[model samples]
Target: MRKGFLLAVALVAFLFPSGAGAAEKVWSNSVPDSVWSDGANWVPAGVPASVDHVVIGRSKTIVGITNAAFAGGLLLSPDVSLDIRAGHNLTLGSGDAAVNIELEGNAEIRTVGASALAFDAVNRLNLNVPSSARLKLGKMSAPAAVHQSGGIVQLTGTVTAAAGGTDWHVNGGLLYVKKNDAFSGNMTVKVAAGKEVQFEKGADAGASFDFSAGSSITSLDVADATSAVPALKLKALTGDVILKLINVPATLAPGDVLRVIDCDSPIPAAAQVRLDPASAAKYEIQLSGDRRSVMIGTRAVASADVVVFTPPTDTLASREYEPGVPFAASFDVTSSAGQALTVTTIPGSSLPVWLGYVVTPKGGASSDVTVTLSGTPDATVSGDIPLGFRASTATASADMTYTIVKKGSGGAPGPNPNPRPGQPGPLPRPNPGDPLLPDPNRKSRSGGGGCDAGLAGIVALLALLPLRSRRRK
Candidate 1:
């Protein structure tokens, strides 16, 4: 029985043959010009069908080694792609390796050592990244260059030319053309030092050019601004940008309030003084320069706006005597240092004893105008407003309150009219018949009750005298 078992085992071993360990399995009927013993295939000339991954020689195979040099090229059809792993080195001509690897649907080529890799018209080329496998070009004599027209190309590692020369050369690297001959979206071209980039006149119309932020170009020669159909709504002129005024109302005029809020950062101050060239009012009142500091004499000083009242047309004719109700004058508070200034107003007084104004920048940002009134008075009295204040926009009514005064043995009351006195102050007088006399609610203490009490008391004393006489009779 033992002899029979031994004979059967020998027969089985012979039939199977250990030669399977030495043989290589070929798939998809794909054959290589030369294959290594350790199952590596080499296509020096080129491959007929596209390949996914090609392994190079291992420890065993000295397969694809060739002493006679020749030009090798690999052309992958549009539907196929190529992937070359690490440790693969393909040597070309006795002079330099002239290997061309072309992949169709977005190919990747990576090389570990001093080698060169080239691409042709691939959608995207990822070089030296493991995730996106690429063809390796081991140490050679020429520089590695890539040219692409359509998709994105990223360089994971430093790339040098195989052919060492300062002169211009286009190694068989990336040469891509747009699949549809149309302009790409948001195209930005960046060129670095020791790098040369060129652009041919685009087939379509001219496009907008932006000299990146904080970046300066030595010279930009545009054919013509009018001819180039630039899509940019604004263009920078002499480092300052000029924008087209959009949605400007026809009614906007010089001295009229035009407030723009919530604008882009670093917005330039708007020219306050704008003239209408075509109108009869050709020369506009220029309130430009600085709002914060006005040059007084030779010195720069912060001053508040002083406007003399322009008498109302309706009251100018009817109102009585003297320089007739002077226009209330007030000021917008501003400081010498382009900062918003604030002034406190007397309670109940429209005229701000202390006022605030946006310090117009010497060359900074724009400021807004806000009005606040304070102080106690018999009536609400407003002061002269600055140039930016349009009366139509003011909350004050057409009528104004003037301080009222009575002789009362005193020639004038309370320092007589301030601002400009002897204009016969318009202080309110107490009437004997008025039931609301000596209004306690009045803001001014003078008008509140003192005057009304004095007049009412005198009349009561006379009435009491008659009553006392009748009682005595």
Candidate 2:
């Protein structure tokens, strides 16, 4: 019958043999004391168990594996290298599928017993754990992570979340214990550049530290601001926030009080405030105790820095409005130079023909310009009614001399009870407040030394990361 069907097809191709082209153990030449299961140091003649698929070279790279090494996939491609020495340990997943690992060089990953060191690697992985290694994170999906830069990473067992995102990049190292240590989801910490990662707070988990500005947001949770909660809460997001009142200590005898910024403490006897050496140097900022806290100095009998436009009254009191009742004064169209500043009003033909000049562009985020000297006295008469105002920009300019007085005999309406303390003029040219008179247009700011001192270390690295408050800024 056709020679017995060609001797039964050559005895079924000489007794079965079809694993679909499996073996690919590459680790040729340059034998630097090899022993990764030894077979003349693995090329294709044996020693690579559990369905092998490995490749180690950029010159064979110190291969040694006393035991525990099973692979179905692994490739340290370009300029390669690997070292799973120190008592051997390396386990990659396969059961639930997806197991790929295709790294590029300098890997010194070590391990031990009781089952650890589990990283699936299906796609992108950057786990550079140095300081000799202790990595244990598996149960894969894809986006794998663990960039420790100087070893020891044991983020709990069973390992959850690692499908779309799984981050923990300290960049330098030392993410050891110190406290609770349990972490669940919310993981996104990338504090690099001279790295630092201090952890604590487990049980249920909570942490927040995002040093904005192109932020990858470092996560922290060291806890202890009287921990019932806070261990770390480092998240500094300040583009600008100023209430500066430095070294303002120089007031002796007008009730000698130089409080920096007191938004509103006790005091409410109709709102008391006693500090006005003629509104010092024409005034620049003053809510006058009624609103409390805005006493910046250099005007105790001065003539220039003028702009503390008043009416924060309770004393020196004499505010009697009858003809249309609402004449006001309180100015601070502010500027540490963040924006809006350009005001001009000049009406002094002996002003008040029963006048009207209501430039009300009020304050907040530094916007204070309140001048509403209502009109109605069409005839009730008055005297010295001068009006002038200016508030420039290009660089800066400020001038004001608004005076209005008209009384049909009553008792209140005061200010200017014989106050003449003048002496301050030259300050329009190149603006020199002077430290040797420097101001050749001087404008260099943000220099405490580079990156504005690294953004003041983001509040000293959010008070040196230990975390609390979660939403932080």
For each candidate, what TM-score against the reference? 0.26, 0.27
lDDT tens digits by residue: candidate 1, 32-112: 323222222432223212111222212212223222112223323222222223444432221222233343343433344
Give lDDT for model 2.
0.43
Off by over 4 Å in 1: 1-71, 78-84, 93-99, 112-153, 162-370, 377-473
- The whole-model lDDT of each prediction reads 0.28, 0.43
Candidate 2's residue-wise lDDT over 277-363, tens digit each? Answer: 443433333445454333333344422322333434423113333455555444344444544556667443344556665656665
